[model samples]
Target: MPRAVVRQRDARHPALPRRAPTPPWTRWAAPVLLAVTVVVQVATPRTLDLSFLLAAVPPLAALAYGPAATALLGGTVLLLLELPHYDLGHPGESDTATVAFVAALSVLFAAVRSRRDAQLVSVRTVAEAAQFAVLPPLPEHVGPVRCAGLYRAAQRGTLVGGDLFDVRRGPRGVRALVGDVQGHGLAAVGTVAALIGAFREAALDQRDLVGVAARLDRRLVIDAEDAGIAETEMAESAGDTGAAGTAGTAGAAGGAGHGEPAELFATAVLLEFAADADELRVVSCGHPPPLLLRGGTVTELAVSPGAPLGLGLAGVAPPEQTAVGLRPGDWILTVTDGVTEARDASGAFYPLTARLAALTEVRQRDPAALADAIWKDLVRFSGGVRDDVALLVFAWER
Candidate 1:
């Protein structure tokens, strides 16, 4: 047996690295500002004592250079301030004391900022852990399909985001969900956690695709009530709320009217691959369609869009399942808007289909290889991704 070499490609947009401590250019900012202030003071008609501007340098240095750099900057500013006194042959007693005070204050500022940076690092670590718990690693193999996925947060130093994807083996088949909550940060992540959690449980218990979709709707309604959103249960329980954001009954997931916290809504796609059938069942909830590649040709599955999740199911028709033929050697690619909406320097959107069309034969044969190729190509297309990206690639091998 020969070993299959899978090239590690950029799977999802890479995690945003923590911002480096003060940049090199900013290190000289205080000094430059100090010099300009002194020049203006010396050249002014009223001989304005702009030396007070020197007070700002210590705080600036503390933010940009930390304690050691601030100490050095403090010394320099003191020296510069004293030079004029030396020329006048009248070095004032209060001026010397004031310079010493500024030096001490700079050290204090530096210490405070250093502490805050450490706290920030701790917060990021905890967030990453929480995200992992919400969207644990998916199995490399799901029944007869080989699968791979990636997720990247839009904000630097953040691990969890509104974008989410999950795969589970249910009674019906191997079910998968990919969705994007309508916001960012902790709030969006909370909604993501809620949605994925509901889907995982529903995938196993629900007999039909519509049943699973209904379960998700009910779960989001429960979440909305717990959060004390403005919309009462009366409207939702009565089946009067209309679809919100992209779809679903409004206020069921988190849709509040104007002046309240904007309700949470998510675009999603649910897929099931039954072992007994040679086809795939899809229910789109106002999400971007999945792309299918076979024989080196790519086609976007055309699904009539349904309401997004979080909207209650009252009066809403059951989601129609679109069954697409699935054959051996075919690949299914699912992505959040982050991938399709990514833009380049020219403001042109990423050409996902064209790039996938260009994939080499070797890359198309292996699921991992295919993922790597798409990620690398997407990175090159977007320069750097500005939003969170989540992608799921599956190859039918049975």
Candidate 2:
């Protein structure tokens, strides 16, 4: 949920969010504005006044810095306002009045800025709490496997996104899941919650991994019905935003009712690692296959894919379960499309297998190291990414 876990040779979970640094332009603009104001006032004589220009500095400063910094810059602008008129002998009260007004305006802007910052902090706190409650953190060690997970949202400044992963220890060994909802933002978040809840309950209640997928599919169908009813009520109370983009598609899925195209669906991979660390059992539903790192070679498991969850229809044939051998020091890396689909500036997709193979020496036998290696490599390869990414790594160690 925090979107980062330690990675690498010494990698730890990703760092927490911090205060954004002030931009360079803001720093230089304030001084440049003040100097220009002084020069114009000195050159123009009394008729063409430029003291008014000094007022612009404080607002610019407010946008760039905190209350203290803005106030200091504002005070400097006010004091400088009278300098050009200084050599001209005692100045008019108009100049004095302009200085006072700029000071007051600066203080007002700072106050407004502080209030907005507080509101943002409040919102972020609530969102983080919701993410923790729904997704939580995966255990570093589950039964016989050493595990780690990471999630990164496509949208900057947000913690959680549409991608999700979870691991649970049950009577049957260890059950894990990684999923990506169809869209992003609050709706995708809601869908993630629905699917994860269904998985947890079903993982324990159902004996097989495919049964877990089926249970999640059925839960989403019901959630779609509930969303439709809610939207209908909302539409009656107020006009709905037209369905056009992702939101429209999602709304259609939820509101389509009985005989229509229900919107909510997700792609997920269900996993079970045996207590003896012999193999990894996989059931993929329209999700990418987990990669295997064994004997200095990286390979993608040959798991048969099934339909995505939430169509209200079963897999034409029961989902195939594939078991990839996991000897000591072997690693299985599961990921969402965000990784495979990440494209570079030239539009070429990331070569996940080749890249992982290249890192064989450094990442071998270490799940976290392998995961971090891939994540950093992907970032560099893609320049930047534009979708939610979720990664889970498991190492079999005797």
Candidate 3:
């Protein structure tokens, strides 16, 4: 998943990461180096004989320029070597030939570097496309409310993680879902995608937040069962194979017993904004209590806890929405355990409530700034986050 991403305000695009451009310092260094070499060779005494410095120009050019440009720089250095080796004085024959050989090698090195760079760019493009398809960038706005989202994976080099959040505007109102699947990493991605798919569909078709939660619950249960059947078929098809024996041993390791149903549950919170009133309907399903920031005070809403989705809880005790009144400037904050449970060297959990109350800047800032400040502070407090962190902020911006 992405190490840390903070997105807000007016970016409707897919957030496609563009090709990294050459650094400005590197681009200008080649020519500046050539000019400085000539000037120093002239300004210094004849005994100094700065022919050796010319060799550096080719390799420096290779850092920012293509093979053709690198060769051109190398050729210029060779011309200087031929013209008495330096404007100041003549260097020894061995030194002159050494500089020439180094320049030639630099040109070839530039060609190899450029080719590998192109290959890297191509691979990056495909990887990003696949990751973003699983969890695309969040929108800037959802009807009257402005939106801000932050996601960070515990593992490096991943654009999407197990934690997922999305805001959608539908016939009911602006609805949002913040969820964290049972586990982290690529292993939980399929579950994340399935949940998001169900949430998006339910957010539009379902008349209320409860219905949306029900939809997600059913999705999790169905997907889990299908996965079990597939696994069974695979295990049976490979009967007596070494791979099957290894799999059975691994599954039975530590007396965990073949995949418990609890592994399928996900803690989530569903919210729906009232189009006509200054209120929000929230249903917490084993998710952390959301924070309500009003003026200068931060209040963690006392939401009734319900069983997590995917454990067949809809029949026993379905999650119900709790109405919370909102003011013009109030901000709602929600996050995964990655943030609240982040620990310090002493193994203390992050004091999110205390920090939110103390950080005066959070109140005056917009939704984007508020989310960024929280994330930055979280990182600073934990020294380094070791789990997937997902945060979402919402404010009535009308």
In what order do the candidates fall by TM-score, top score first? 2, 3, 1
Worst 10-residue lDDT window, candidate 3: 8-17
Which portions of model 3 miss their true places by more than 4 Å? 1-57, 85-105, 125-137, 155-159, 185-188, 225-262, 276-278, 314-316
RMSD of each: 9.3, 6.2, 4.9
RMSD of 3: 4.9
Cand. 1 TM to true fold: 0.65
Instruction: For model 1, state the Cα shift of residue 148 in Å.
Output: 1.0
Q: What's the TM-score of each model vs. the native? A: 0.65, 0.78, 0.77
lDDT tens string, model 2, 106-219? 778877877786777676566666667777766778778789777777766555679888888755678999999889755588888888888889878888788888898888
Q: Model 3 residue 6 lDDT?
A: 50
lDDT of 1 at 336: 94
Candidate number that wins on TM-score, 1 or 3: 3
Q: Write the per-residue lDDT of candidate 1 for residues 280-315, one digit (tens) a residue.
A: 889998899999988868899998788987777656
Q: Rate the local accuracy (lDDT) of all candidates.
A: 0.75, 0.74, 0.79
Which lDDT value does model 2 have at 369? 62
- The best candidate by lDDT is 3
Screening candidate 2 with a backbone cut-off below 3 angstroms (N, C-alpha, C), the clashing residue pairs are: 4-14, 5-12, 5-13, 5-14, 6-12, 6-13, 7-11, 7-12, 253-262, 253-263
